[model samples]
Target: MIYYQWGYYLTKQQILDLYKTWGGKFGRFNPHDLTDIFHARRSIFHYLMPGPVRVWIAGNDAGDGVLFFVGKPNCPIRESVEPDLAERCLAMFGGPPCPFTLVPNTGGEAYIMKRKGKLYKMDLIQFMQSDTKGDQYPLSLDEILPEQMHLLGL
Candidate 1:
């Protein structure tokens, strides 16, 4: 099975605010029921009440805050839910920044970033694999935006 996961990195306060605002709407089991899950300094994953689309929030290794949202490939949630949530977060918390996705089993990876008020999408593996240099693959992530670097856990 192929799974597509993507999210934005956020600050701790932002995560908390998100939980407070949207947690209740997640259906049946309140993610808040898990005591201290959000408060912990380390990474944590809180699986929200499941439905047609599965959603969860987890702290990134960087520990700045958390990486949120993940959905299956071709899931309508990507078009319907993700953009709306991203826009809301961007308006409320300053960014819907560094949106990225890694599709397991498919070698698919990409990130969307804002530069000079314009958004650009870059396909990492594709760029790295490009034959621009006589079979010499790109040796670094230097070409990638700073916000996008974290997607590789760098």
Candidate 2:
């Protein structure tokens, strides 16, 4: 069971707003998404996030945190978040608009392509360490009580 966390620097309020608007439902790739090279490779990439919301204190106690959810809602698969930590992670884009993308298994881990056909990739470790302000590790399920796991639909 592979799970992914799409990292984003969003406020706590913004997170709540997203839940209210999207009903906690995250996004999946659509046909139009293929134009983006990063998204074009995988049709079901978003399904990788199936764990609880992983949060890391970033710059402040509240309002700022490196937060993201796991897999898709009602996902039948279950896996400890530990292995994902050891697995490859997401990378921040150098340009504006889309700031992040999943680091591919081979080649450069970070990528950016210009409208004019230019493309680039960056070091995965450096990006995660510096761009994120600090390393953000995945949250583990072992700490959660078995009875409460269902609340997260895990």
Candidate 3:
């Protein structure tokens, strides 16, 4: 089964303060969104982040750890924090070009792929491989894991 860790750091009150001050660079800031934005964004992206506060899990790629502070209402760090992290997060999980697109065929079933007018129904790595060198390789049941399939809502 596909398992992932989800977590959060700061308290709801702290997140609200950050949203009130720096959420614009996090993307947008609406007074009504002090509670909704983080969860809504997580749902759309399918990333189970550990926070409405500050923390990272499967999807955070900044490499440099993220640290959030309960700064004064309009501190310089607060202004810079979300935007910089937004750019970093976007570039890491997001891909080249859009910096926020679903990178195709990454460690999961791609279903189908298009290339040069032909369709690739298997993973490119699997397709390019040949058994000419050996034939004793064991098979994996990755193709029919029921729990994994259920995750796709199939």
Candidate 4:
């Protein structure tokens, strides 16, 4: 399984700033270590940085303003690691914490979301279908299951 988190609303400069800061502090391989093919990809920039665990931070030059963290495959990001990372990211980016997940090959993957400083888990597919805009805050696993059960009620 691979763990990841997504964040939005950053300029290309901000992304580069993050890469530099993280690379200097924790990167096992620096930006210069990336292959030419990776550098040639103009839309996205990524660097592999290893702290307590390995992670890749990436962003795009497109106006979408998206940045993401990808943990190395088969390595689960520790619980302590994510909150610390998210806190720092929030301090820098000034937005809601994005969803974090351990994506599995089987179905029913759960996404960890933060609302009002409390964390909640929701099924990945349900979150995508209903909360892509994040209107459904403070959601709970029980809430999702019951709604589906109601739909199937006859």
Candidate 5:
């Protein structure tokens, strides 16, 4: 099955570094140290599998991002999602149907939300850096913009 996993706050350099370290073989989507927020809870499944893996990453003009991981069929990391989980993610982020939209942070939590024609993200880093919270978390799409010009080298 195909597991579509999404991520945020990661730079292209970091991904390339991981790709090189892993010898182009995809493995667990371990959260990065700099990952201030955005949690993909399903990532736990990745630890249960071991094999050659494929991973794809994407991001918006902001620093927010997405990742697509295809695991071996019947494996723990393979595509497996529950309707209830999807519902909770959608309700919290308020976007179109997504396979995964959670991102991890330091101590707190954060997520991405879309409204009108714009896309915005909330992250714990923002809170620490700017002392923002709740509705304020969704207020700054510009707050978390990355200095990197590209994402996942694309």
Candidate 6:
């Protein structure tokens, strides 16, 4: 039948790179392209593994989350998504013995807004962390003024 299906999918490296704040405008950009890349399968993954599964769309905040199902029933997960479902999907994929898959979000802008639901965005982890941390490690250099450096060690 050639049915076309597209949903939330991202490589672990893409997720990791976004976590590093390589993206912009709500951390929206391809993670793999960034120099900061984490090695993974580069493909073969979904928040909830495809197959009689449920997919949810969550924002960066706690109370702001929604759900969306992607399997047979095609419903949503509405209880503040935990790894429980992901674990279940893992089990379905042949347990821990089964191999893993990796895929990147590329740029959240395009996919993040797909059929809004009540759950955290896959990139939420990175978005919040970057705001607090500011992408890379904050240089202590900024903490000390130009004159303060020579005086302290001088």
lDDT of 4 by residue, 1-154 (tens): 3555543323334544554444322222223433211221111221221212211223222332223333222334444345555455455446543545543653634445444666544332222111123212232334333334444352
- Residue pairs clashing in model 1 are none
- Each candidate: RMSD: 16.5, 15.7, 21.6, 20.0, 17.2, 15.4
lDDT of 3: 0.28
lDDT of 4: 0.35
Question: Candidate 1: which stretches are off by over 4 Å?
Answer: 1-5, 11-57, 70-87, 103-154
TM-score of each: 0.30, 0.24, 0.18, 0.25, 0.23, 0.20
- At residue 98, candidate 1 shows an lDDT of 37
lDDT of 1 by residue, 31-127 (tens): 3432232332111122221212221233333333344443334444446345544455455446433334453443454434333565544333212
Per-candidate clashes, comma-separated:
0, 5, 2, 0, 7, 16
Clashing pairs in 4: none
Number of the top-ranking candidate, with lDDT as the measure = 1
Clash total of candidate 6? 16
Cα lDDT computed for each candidate against the true fold:
0.37, 0.31, 0.28, 0.35, 0.33, 0.30
Off by over 4 Å in 3: 1-8, 23-154
- By lDDT, the better pick of 3 and 6 is 6
Score candidate 6 by lDDT. Answer: 0.30
Q: Give a tens-digit lDDT track for model 6, residues 9-96.
A: 3343434543344221221233433222211111122324433332222333323222222232212332222356546544433332
Off by over 4 Å in 6: 1-14, 18-74, 78-85, 88-154
Candidate 1: residue 3 Cα off by (Å) = 5.8
Q: Evaluated with TM-score, which candidate comes out highest?
A: 1
Which of candidates 1 and 6 is the stronger one according to lDDT? 1
Candidate 4 clashes: the total is 0
